[model samples]
Target: MPRALLRPVWRTLPRRALVAAAAAGLLLAAVPRMQSGPPDPQLGLFALRAAALAFGLGLAFLLDDPARHLTTAVPVRRPVRIGLRVALVLPWAVLCWTTALLLVPAPARPPAGDLTLEAAATAVLALTAAALMTRRTLITEPGVMTSTWLLCTAAAAYLLLPHDRTLLVTPDDPRWQTTHTHWALLLAAATAVGLRACTDPVRARLRPRLSS
Candidate 1:
C-alpha cells in the first residue's frame, strides 16, 4: 500500500530538475580549471562552495508540493508522504555529491570529510527551512520562499559574521575541528526542527502562503 502511494508522489517529484541544477554546479567545479597550470587551493575551494551551494539550493525545492491541497484529503499522513519524497531523493543526492567530489582535483580539494560534513549540514538546513516554512505558512510554493531565505542567510553568514577561530572551516583555517563541531550541532538542531515540523498538528492546519 505504501509502495502504491509512492508511485504518484514519485511521479510529481522534480528529480530531473534538481539533478540538472546540481549538474550545473558540478560543471562549474570541474570545467574552467587550468589543466596545465599549478593547483590553486582557493579556486578549488570556490568550486567546492559552488557545488555545495547548488546542492543546497536544489534541496530547498524538495519539500515543494503544488498539489499539497489535493493530498491533504488522501488517507496517508503528511509526514509519511514527505518522508517518501526524501527517501527517493537520497540516492540521487549521494550520486550528485559523489560526482562533484570526483570532479575536483585531489591536491586542491579540502579534506573530503570536512567538506562532506559541510555539504550535509547545508542540505539538512535547506530541508529544515522548507519544512519550517511549510508548517508555519503552509505555502504550496515553499521552494521559492526557502531558496530566497537560504541564500540571504548564507550570504549574511559569510559576509556579516565576524571572523573568529570558532567559525566555519575554510581552506587554511586552523580551527577545522572546532568549526565542524558547530556544523554537527547545526545538523542536529535542523534535523530536530524538521521532525517537529512534520508532527501531526492538534488541528487541521493549513496556513496561507507567504504571499497570501
Candidate 2:
C-alpha cells in the first residue's frame, strides 16, 4: 500500500477486535504450558476448539468501524478499502495461529492439519458474517451483531447434528473425514460471500428518456 494511504487505512482498523484476537492467541499459546502434569488428551481437544472459537470471534469483527459510514463515502472504491483492511490483518492472523500451534507441545497438540482447517473455516465465516452485516444490514456497529450470530450458528451446527454425524469430531473418530468435508465447503462459501460483500455495489446510471 502507498504510504499516503497507510495512515487512513490504519486509522480505520478495528483496534478492539484486533486486540481481542491477539489476546485469544496469547491464551491459546499459554494454556498448554500452564498445565503441570503430562498432556491430557481431552484438554488438548478442548483447547483447540476454544482457540478456533476465539479466533473466529476476533476475526468476525475485523470489518467493524464506528466511522464506516464516513469511510464508505470516500473516493476510493469499496473493494480497495475493504481489501486493504483485510490485507493489514492477514499477517497477524497467520502469526497468531502459528504461535498458538507451536506453543502447544507436539504430543499434546491436536491434529494440526484438521484443527487448522477448522480454524480457517471459522475465520472465513466470521469475515463473511461481518461483511454481510456491514453491507447488507447497514448497521452502525457490525462486529457485536455478527459475532453473536457466528457463535450461535456454530453452537447450532454442533447441537443440531445427530450423535453419529457431529461437527466437532476428533481426527481419530470415524466421522472426522465427513466433518472436515463440511468445513472445507464452509470455507469456500464464506470466502465467496466475503468477496461479494467487499465488491463495490453496482451503481445504476440512469439515462435521460427521449420522447419518441
Candidate 3:
C-alpha cells in the first residue's frame, strides 16, 4: 500500500509552489553575497530569516489535496498519507535550507546553529497550522490562509513580545540563549500539535472497532 501510494501522492504534491518558494529562499539567502562591499552581519541574519520564512510559507501548503474528499475513503489512514507526503518532501526542504545557509558568506554569517533552530521552529509552526486547518475545516487548500496567519503572527511577536521573551534577538544579546530556549520549546509543541492534527477522525477510528 505504501509503495502504491508513492506515485499518486507524488503527482498530487504542490510542486510549483514548493519549487518557487525554494527559489525565493535561495535568492534571499544569496542577497548578502550579492552586496558590493563587505557584507553586513545584520543583513546576513535578515537574509537567512527571510529565507526561512519563505520556506515555511511553501510548507504551509504541504497537506493540501484537491481530491481530499475522494481520497477520504481510501484504506490507508490519514496520518499515514500525511506522513508519507512529509517524508517525501522533508529531504528536499532540508537541502534547500542547507543551500540557503551556504549562500551566505562566512564572514557575514550569524551563528549557524542558532539560525538553524529558528528556521526549524518556523517551518514546524507553519506545518502545524496547516495540519490543523485541514483537520478542522472544509477548506482543501489552506496555504494562503495559513501563510497569512504565520506572517501576521510573526510580525505580532516581533512587535509585541517582551524583551526578556523575544525570539529575534541578536547573537551578541544577553537574551540569545533564552530566545533559543523558547524556540526549542516552540518546536516541540508544534511537532506535537501537528502530529495530533494529522490523526484519523473519530468516526474512522470507531469503524474498525464496530466492524470487529
> Highest lDDT: which candidate?
3
RMSD vs true structure, all candidates: 4.4, 3.5, 1.6
Off by over 4 Å in 1: 31-36, 205-212
* Ordering by TM-score: 3, 1, 2
Whole-model Cα lDDT of every candidate shown, in order: 0.80, 0.78, 0.92
Candidate 1 per-residue lDDT, tens place, 1-212, comes to 56888889888887765877688778877852655687777777778777888888888999888888788777677789889989999998888888888787888777888788888988989888988887777688698778788889888888888888334547667777888888888889889988888865546544433335
Better of 1 and 3 by TM-score: 3
**Model 3 lDDT, residue 187, Cα:** 94
- Cα-based TM-score, every candidate: 0.90, 0.88, 0.95
Clashes of each: 0, 0, 0
Model 2 Cα displacement at 103 (Å)? 1.6
lDDT of 2 by residue, 1-212 (tens): 44456688888787887788678766976687789989866677777778778888988777877787776656576677777877898898888887888778777888888888989988988888888777776686788888899889878877897877677887678888888898898789889988998776544111112221
Lowest lDDT 10-residue stretch of candidate 1: 202-211
Quote the positional error of residue 158 for candidate 3 in Å: 2.0
lDDT of 1 at 30: 88
Better of 1 and 2 by lDDT: 1
